[model samples]
Target: MYTLSLEVVNKCNLNCSYCYLGEKKNTSMSIDTAKKAIEIAVHEVQKQYDKTLVIYFIGGEPLIAFNVIYEIVAYTKSRCMEMNLKYMFSITTNGTLLTKKIIDFFIKDKFEIKLSLDGSQEVHDLNRKDYQNVGSFLTIINKLKLLRKYEKESDKKVSYAHVVTKNNYQHFEKNFQFLIDLGAERVETGIDYYCTWNNDEMKGLGIQIVNVFALYKNQVQIEKKRIYWNLLEHYLEMYLTTCNFYACKAGLNSMFVAVNGKIYTCIELPEFQIGSIMEGLNIQRIREIAYVEDKLSESCINCKYKSICKTRGCQASNYEIHRNIYEPVEVKCRMTKVFLNLIENNFTSQQLENLKIREDR
Candidate 1:
């Protein structure tokens, strides 16, 4: 309901280890295809949701089809203006192709760009590299520097996203500090959901990430508004205003449209292909996908700590041949419990007793 994310191209230059696209054939969306998606997206915005619409440029590498993106943005803006609609732009991109022109475009248009960066140079180079085995660290760092210079020249903020992995988990604070020094106005960090490792490996990686996070929390002196544990922060922010929560929103408000116009409930379900834009962009199809109840197979469904846990059953698990639904991984679950326990310990006795009494009643 908030954003309509679509892929214009599935042709990436870099071969990231954790990429969901994973050796998938590269494909680019034609301008006709782009127009179809735009028309459907704009129509849905005008006819359905009242909130401000945001068109998210998602891709194997959105910047690969930069001209298409520019065209879509210009066309959408003009149409929205004519229709008196409110809208904005967002894109998630690897920093490899973020040239000066792209940065200038983002700055001039105030488009939100979320560049993917792992923790540090060594950590990033390990997983995010070009086909020629070249490390992308220096190139991306240079691009980031350019972005910072833009901020100095124009006094506008640029956003950065850090994907936490076992390789760089130990350097969370250091990496974050580096970004801060780069003059990034906002930053968000999260676990790499597209990890190739199996359950145990993922669990180990989760623990490593948390270990690094604890170290970061203890060591860093973050004085400004930066997002740590992005998932939990977003959940808490939403819950503070509205008393609604969910362990998963696979089919709920969020929708992902792939480059071929196939729609999905979540990015994790990219292959599921729930519908297509060629069919008039039916919101009902999305609702059906979200509302269709699948059997909950997680071992920790009964765990009291499940409510606060950030890592749980993923989209891949649902589509797997065996459908392994494990409880929230131990690392995330334990960390959530630890944080919650700290909060409860700090509460006044009277307040704690009042909460208990309310629960009893």
Candidate 2:
């Protein structure tokens, strides 16, 4: 399975404080560029081992360029109609621009829509605000309600993603509950990786994550609530499977295409452009990005948590913080070990058996 991401527009309506794409530009992917990207993803590239591709649309906010997304999906569907491939559509949106028409389109396409909602109104508004410095939670909540209504009356699945920042680190359980209450069956979270995280914040965040895991366990094992927590499920899968999961899959099987046709391993590393749609992928640069030695570090190989830590990081993140793609971020490493320890030290034999049963089903 591979993913082809199109940064439909380098523009957004909201001016989020923690946005990685710091500056807003008027750039957008034209129909010609998008078609070229689609062709490169499906035809120009060889995919003998795969039969599925996730055609993902992202942006400062993708809905701002909905027409491009609409056209791209249609074109891709037509292009792949006869190929031995099945395609899926997904989008990450701020939820402010979702209209009945947009929602209908998503339903018709069966898009895996991930709505950006940071838990509660206060927490969400603290950083996720509009250009005028107003909170967007009020506007998005009504849309979320409408989405849940549609899901209840149909077979569509809507997921929620929230960022855990300094503003909401202490409210982990509450945040999860708030999203769950809003009918979010599948929820995911990301930490503000670029933001300052001192020892105190790190400690608090670790505790918050542990508590969140405990809450997930209670919900599933005791309360009989049905939900999906990305972290917990990932750990369970790691424990039960062949320990196959990537900390970051920046340049392998997945590639990010910008509005200007520049290709990079990940959106987080715009400066590390490895290729362009016009020139195809830079194999040498991609290999270098993955590291020349085919290894991250000697220390990582010898580390006790090698299985959990092998693919445990984004090269872009490493380069950003340490000026080296092969090096791992210290704080994030601590957090990953912490995340594993929570599952290992907390889950009982019976609970694990139950988890395996859930997975089997």
Candidate 3:
């Protein structure tokens, strides 16, 4: 699988406090640039003989560049069909700009939609605010209600991507329950790696995770109900597979194309530019990013949980925190150890063995 993430626009209507983009620029992707990016991405996938191509639209707000998105999707579909390549499309949005027309288009095209929300109205309003400093919770919730209505009439499932922060860490269960109440069955949430966490906050987060895990075990293992919690699912998969590597597919089979045509290994790491759509990929830079795992810290190499640990850590976060991709974030490392211990303590040896057998098959 090859994923091509396009940054459709560099402008946003919201001034989210934890936004990685920092300052907003008044820039949007031109149709010409979009076409070239699509061509370059398609050629790369074809050259690599990838079976699947995923066109992922992202931005400060992708919906802000809806016209450009429409053009690219239409063009990419035709191009992929002509080349006999299988393709899938997806978009990550803030959910503030969702409209009936946009919802209809996504449903018709079967585009995977991920909406950014921070659970309850109060927690969401703490950071996610509009340009005028107004809370966006009500606006987003209203839009989400409309989306849920359309989703029931179509085959599409809208998933939520939540950001957990120190402000809401103590209320994790409450936040999660709020999303469930808002008609979200599939929820993807992660701690803000960039935020500083106090000891109390970390402990609270651990307790919350454990509570959620217990709930997940009861529902899935006991009641046999189908629900998706990304964090719980990831740890469960790691336990079942016993996989050694946990690196993200950023530079390996995925890339981010900026609005101005510059390319990077991942969208969050704009400083690590690999090339541009106009000049094509920089082979040496790509190779360096692909082999970044080889430059691991000695601590990681000697850690007891190195083998079974599925937390290879995000290179972008590592670079931002430690100024080196190989240097693991101490907080994340500690959290991983705690999480693994929790798993070891919760499940019996026989249950784990059964899971392995089932997964391995």
Candidate 4:
């Protein structure tokens, strides 16, 4: 799989506190740049014989440059058809600029849409606000409703991408349920590592995650509904199998292209830029960054749970917390251990005994 993340624009209508894109530069991708990016990405995909190519439109808000996206999608579809390549289009947006026309275009193109919704109106409005200091909750909710209406008419499912922060940790379950109530079938969230989480906040987050997991299990077992909790799904998958140290795809098969055509291994870690689309990718730099082992600390290497733990976590978060990609953030690692412990403690002796008995039979 090959992923090409195009930063369609660097300008946003709303300001989120923890956005990786620090400030709006009022810059958007020109058609020439967009065409060159697609051409280069397609060439690489063909050269590598990649089975699938994913063109992800990301930014301050991709819809801000809807025209550019329109052209790129049209061109990509045509080019991929000519080459007989498998490809898909996706976008991440704040959901404030969605319109019926935009929704129609997305449906026609079968684009996977991810809305940046934190949770309930109050929780989301606290950190995600517009330049005028106005909450965008109502506006986004209206757009979500419109999206839901259209989604029912199409095969594509609209999902929510949430960012969990200290302000919203306590209300995690409530916010999750709120999105579910708003017709979101898929809800994915990750911790905002930029925020300093104290001891109490970490415990609160652990409790919230356990509670949500229990609720999710009940929904699957009793209610028989398919609910996708992105964080829990990922951890559960890792818990049930051996952990791979270098799980991230950055600098390997994935690359982030900025609005100015600069390329980085990971979108969050812009400091380590590999190359530019115009100049072409630095394969040597990519190999050096991607193949470097020993991302774990000495203590982590000898930890009892090393085999099952995601020691590498997120490179971006590791860099943000420790100012070094190789050093694991102690706080984040502790939080992960707390969540894993909760998962381990939830299964009772009787439950384990029953599983053992079933396996023996």
* Top lDDT model: 3
Please, what are the lDDT tens digits per residue for candidate 2 over residues 1-361?
6789999999999999899988888688999999888887886334636567788899979999999999998998887776767788999999999898888788788788888999888888988998799999999977866686557654767778999887788987799988877777888888777777889988998898888887777877798888877766666665654433334455667889998999988864666787898998887887666654434465476766766553354567767887776677766766777776877788798978898787776
What TM-score does candidate 4 get on C-alpha atoms? 0.90
lDDT of 3 by residue, 161-206 (tens): 8888877777777788787667777889877878887778777777
Give the clashing residue pairs of candidate 2, or none. none
Worst 10 residues of 4 by lDDT: 352-361
Instruction: For each candidate in the order shown, give its overall lDDT on alpha carbons.
Output: 0.63, 0.79, 0.80, 0.79
User: TM-score-based ranking, best first?
Assistant: 3, 4, 2, 1
Error of 4 at 146 (Å): 2.0
* Model 4 C-alpha lDDT per residue in residues 1-361, reported as the tens digit of each score: 6788999999999988888778679899988888887777787777555557789999888999999999999999998898888898999989999999998888888889888999888999999999899988899887766787668767777879888887888888888878777777788887787778888888888888777777777776898777777776566555665566556757667778889988887764656588887888888887767666745677587766777776555566677678777677766677667666765787686764664465454
List the lowest-lDDT window of 10 residues for candidate 2.
Answer: 240-249
TM-score of every candidate? 0.78, 0.90, 0.91, 0.90
Q: What RMSD, rounded to one decimal, does every model reach?
A: 5.2, 2.8, 2.4, 3.8
Instruction: Give me the displacement of residue 308 in model 1, in angstroms.
Output: 5.4
- Global lDDT for candidate 2? 0.79
Regions of model 4 farther than 4 Å from truth:
47-50, 268-271, 342-361
Best by TM-score: 3
TM-score of 3: 0.91
Write model 1 residue lDDT over 1-361, tens digit each, in one string.
4467778888888887777676756887777776676666666666546646688888888999899889888887887787778888888888778777887887776777777876568777888888998878888877767667557665665567777665665566667666656655466776553344455655555555455445444434454444344543443332223221233554344456777777766563544455676875455755554444434345556756444443344433434423443333444444455445443454577855565565454
Clash number for model 1?
1
